[model samples]
Target chain A: MRIRKLIPGVDANLLIKDAGKLMQDPMRRSFLRGAASLGALAFLTGCDIIDGDAAEGVLRKISELIDGAQAALVSRTKLAPTLKESDITRPFPFNAYYTEDEAPAVDPATYRLEVSGLVDNKKPWTLDELHALPEVSQITRHVCVEGWSAIGSWQGAQLSEFLKRIGADTRAKYIWFKCAEGYTNTIDMPTALHPQTQMTFKFDNKILPRAYGFPMKIRMPTKLGYKNPKYVVAMEVTNTDHGGYWENQGYNWFGGL
Target chain B: MTAETMTASQDAPIHPGWVRICHWINALAILVMIGSGWQIFNASPLFDFTFPRSIALGQWLGGAIQWHFAAMWVLVINGAVYVTLGIVTGRFRRKLLPIYPRDVVADAKAALTFKLAHDDLAHYNAVQKLLYAGVIIVAVIVVLSGLAIWKPVQFQELTALFGGYDFARYVHFAAMAAIVSFLVVHVALALIVPKSIRAMIAGR
Candidate 1:
């Protein structure tokens, strides 16, 4: 605290020597690094709330302005957050899903994603059976709403393959994925079948992390992290609509960033 | 008047114009990075490892990335140049050599107290020395954590340094806060002692 008052003109030379002393000390360097890191985290915590409030205010004003206008840009009944492609799956920088679970004992020879919605056919094709149909692979970035992202190559069968196999009903508009963890998320059918969207079984040139939905995980290159449900277990083709876990918690259903 | 100030300025000038330029330029780069970094941080609010602040909006998140990446290059390159020059020219040893143990302990009091604020460009007071070293070290951590988050695949080991992506991000944020605090104090001192600020700008 005493150094707080050291005005430069008083002792320029001594100040330089003192600086030299501090720099030469290893213990001092470590202390300063650790201390600075702490300080930055504390400040970030405080600022988060302030910015969140500002965002809420902006959203409200936008909604109010729309209500007051004669020719509203979007109908009140149809006013929903913009559906950006990037919002499908956001990535977290360090949340790698690590699991040691072996591939399911369910023999791949007989395992198949049962496509049963408004579809015409309701058959379960084996792994080879599905692979016999077609393969889909894509390299895309997974953007997490928590402010982290990663790009990886994903390879698997296309969701539309199963949909077409079962003969998807013409009226079905949403594709819901049921994960092994009982987590469920849905995306518009067209978006689900986008070229970049894949029902990936391999990640980064390796077998998928079991925790990452080893058998399969939905990869929506454009959405936020949460939207890409891991450990996917089931698929539901539906005409109705619903949101994922985080989505119901006030998070954007389509987190593009 | 203070012994600390008298002793510091007693010796011949040690900080040359080049050294001074490097010093202030480093500070400028850091300040811009911190300010813009804050604007970008607000996008995803995390605190105390608790719940996240939900309200978030910013297209400037991308802008933040640009500013940070740009400022980072400046900090890294300038810092590298400064260190290289210091070592090559023996300026590091000549200007930064520590005083004896007795004087360090004795003057440590005045140095800590800034009772030695009589001259401009006296190099760095004991506390200033500590702080300057500190800011540089923190800047290093910022770069490391940044790399971890930026190219996780390519720098998987680097990412592991901060416990992974989320933690690396946390570390990066924390480093910024520390640097900002140092900057705040630096500015306050400059304003409090106009002579120092003038020296920095006019290069006396």
Candidate 2:
């Protein structure tokens, strides 16, 4: 069959030899050609194997390398930019794996902060006791791994002071957090000791709302939001990694900003 | 002339062997970066639309980030080498500099009419120089914004240049769009004049 000429000066038959190729425009054809190139690159790098487990294994290792690069860039002295009170995002975004209503409700009356593993004190403490420690607050941007951010004021106990109070083995590599919602996460010791890292008890001068991790949240402005676990029920200072909920599912553990 | 001299005298290859190698490697790295970056962008889209899933590289956000970071190394190092070699060999001056606006306007008009000649591979039309030069600047912007997002605190000055952590993302996306535009035109021209593609591959 003869094809209709699409352009006045050009014959359609000359432009495309096959009906299959003709169906798609040149731009789309080249875009798909890019996908083909994606396959070639995947074959060469062995990391984009979307259909197989082999790809995940390679990609995960590369993620670890990136984590190292990010970690190396971090300086204990350098702090994430602090925002003015006026800069705070009104109704800061509520984000979680579950719905907002589903956020874990840990009664402040019953909440007991458990401490263990390489700590001089393994004793549990009440929320009231945590509140009594010297208080601090700062307005800072909370960067999420998913590529969103919101500036908010957070008030809490300095993590370094608390760690020192418990005589936590600060030399240990990690500080693992267990949350009331079965969420878990870990941060390196330097991050644990970062001036901005806090055992946050309040958001915007009020007790943290459930959607923002009621009772407690570990706030690390230098790291992505996921690295800042919320509704933290327990913390263990340890050398072992004990990868968290998202980390095990393939999110990079470092997750630095 | 003797046979050896005769062979040497034959139309010399337009692209050097180093240029061809760098060109291909850079192309592959860009594909990986764009593909994976789109997957990441899909996680929490900046705009209303997202790049289709088929066009994205890695299957998931973490996986995409992995590809993005891995290809980042290749892109950075290869780009550095390309720029260094471009300077050392004066490829920049000879092929892509002194792009007069008059020439660009004429060439653009020729291009739109499909009258621009690409058969002569030894010299580039004004449009090609403008694009090549513009894309290099865009590439640098993309990398800088990426670093600002990656380590905002350590690279605070860079982040501040783009108006801080969140704003840097916009800059990165804009730069990516610019690059994709360049690629579309580049690949389209390569299709229109297939010899350019052959010359790129065969260093002729």
Candidate 3:
């Protein structure tokens, strides 16, 4: 009767019959015998349908738990699979919240990458100056969160190398990027230092086209496409959490693939 | 045992509460997963045509992913419980295992020609055993491949085992198709033999 009261709207007689059946079934009895623990009961109660902000808060906590678990599991040394040049998707489909024509056009002459926050250098580097840094290229798959993928060749300076050049605090928790299109995102320090996390300025062996985050994009093969900010014009390193556009919109903050 | 003994077995309790409860829960979880997965796939369809919006659970990609990830935990936990209990109770051995090659061929022929036996609803024929076994294996693969795709960098070894991220997706989609086909046959057979469904629900 007390259990029926706790379960609210359920028919008490039906619950009793099911419980009686469970007791008679050896397999079910054994399975559920251990489930009498308070923790299991609490978990089941938590999963019950509830109303309003309380339920939303529970869901958010679950998401946060998933994010923490995923963050813990990421490996710094693991690399996204790389494909051969011939394997690249020809005429790679462009994807964004906006159409290709709506892509922001930044004037190359005036474009300067500003570095600040937890960095010794607060200077701005022009496209030429950033491009002149040591270049590295890789042919890796760009995996979109939306269930499609495209292989493309990306060339740029390693983000870790660039971070060091800017005299950034390597121990900082996050490396946030601000793009010309008003897009902002952040990556963990380990991801920021990953060998494949590049400040990409070239695609298919040419200056990055406007369609593909021209001027510069953080080409993070290790992360989902959304985590890789494009047209990045400013960056900051900080210990405080700065949730990204999609992340703030309920997408997983880690956004690792 | 003789045919009489086999017939008598049908009257005895065959479906346990664990099996029945887990079965229905798994079915519900899988249906949610499939619908949400289709919604997610529709966001970036591999082929030209898109999955109809009517059958999809969540209208948007973000909402679909939430549904997917939520259902994923249910599927994984329920499936794990089923598998662990099956192995522990030796139910798999008693109900579906050691399917001989001869039995399979004979069963296949009998099934194709509509000569399959249903006198003992409690017992599994060689074909039924094989299908059940195959589905369990495929379910495990689907879960593992789903994990690999979900966290390629974290589960790098698992992803490498499936060849790569793209190949992992291929495997996941293919496994889903296999499960869907199995569901079709399973539901059809249940409809053809409504008694088995009743036995599952009431533990006759």
For candidate 3, what is the total of clashing residue pairs? 1
Q: How well does each candidate reproduce the native contacts, as fnat?
A: 0.05, 0.46, 0.29
- Sort the candidates on DockQ, descending order: 2, 3, 1
TM-score for candidate 2 (chain B): 0.93
Quantify all predictions' global Cα lDDT against the true fold.
0.55, 0.81, 0.78
Q: Which stretches of candidate 3 lie over 4 Å from their true place?
A: A1-60, B1-12, B101-121, B160-163, B192-195
DockQ of 2: 0.29
Backbone collisions counted per model: 52, 1, 1
Alpha-carbon TM-score of each model against the true structure: 0.45, 0.88, 0.80
TM-score, second chain, candidate 3: 0.93
Clashing pairs in 3: A257-B152
Candidate number with the higher TM-score (2 or 3): 2
Please give the lDDT score at residue B132 for candidate 2. 93
Weakest ten-residue segment in model 2 chain A by summed lDDT: A27-36
lDDT of 1 by residue, A158-213 (tens): 76665666777645777777665456687766556555567777765566755456
Model 3 per-residue lDDT tens digits across residues A175-244: 9899887889988899999999999999999999998999999999988888988889999999988888
